[model samples]
Target: MAGHPLKKIQCESIARTSGKQCRAKGYLKKSGHYRCRFHGGASTGAITLEGKLIAYKNLKQFKNYTDEQLLIWIQNKLQKSSSV
Candidate 1:
């Protein structure tokens, strides 16, 4: 029996914990990159202003900024979006 042809394309991403190449099979992306499901294979990122704001607020480092600072950042992002 032959192995799955897709198995030949291993993920090229390095694991954050082990710092080694990921061994999972990777899916080819429109951006010409290969990433396994565990490594953002389906992530398209925040595409809208509201989505970006939500993503920013959910960042791990959000604790470092005060509410006023966060509001200022959001306002700035809104301005940029409006300008674009």
Candidate 2:
């Protein structure tokens, strides 16, 4: 896949409804389809540390941001979520 480097880390979860394990892998804008490492080749959807769905375009815009910054952003989004 393109020249962009793959993300070092990834997050995984199981869909309660479908029972299908879902994994999110970070990829470059050139990556055609957004998918987990196992099933599909690449991914298009960007997922935050806290599991928020950020637009793929936005991900490209902030691709230069440090991992710490991205983690903080994800934490902030998680903070806004309703307590379970």
- Winner by TM-score: 1
Write one digit per residue (lDDT tens) for candidate 2, span 21-47: 564553333445344556454554445
Model 2: colliding residue pairs: 34-43, 34-44, 35-42, 35-43
Clashing residue pairs, backbone N/CA/C < 3 A, model 1: none
Best by lDDT: 1
The C-alpha local distance difference test score for the whole of candidate 2 amounts to: 0.52
Model 1 local distance difference test score = 0.78
Cα lDDT tens digits for candidate 1, 1-84: 257865479778999999999988788877787888898548768777567667787788876876667778888867898999
Q: Which residues of candidate 2, in runs, are more than 4 Å off?
A: 1-58
Candidate 1 regions exceeding 4 Å error are 1-7, 45-84
- At residue 34, what lDDT does model 2 achieve? 41
**Model 2, C-alpha of 53: deviation from truth (Å):** 11
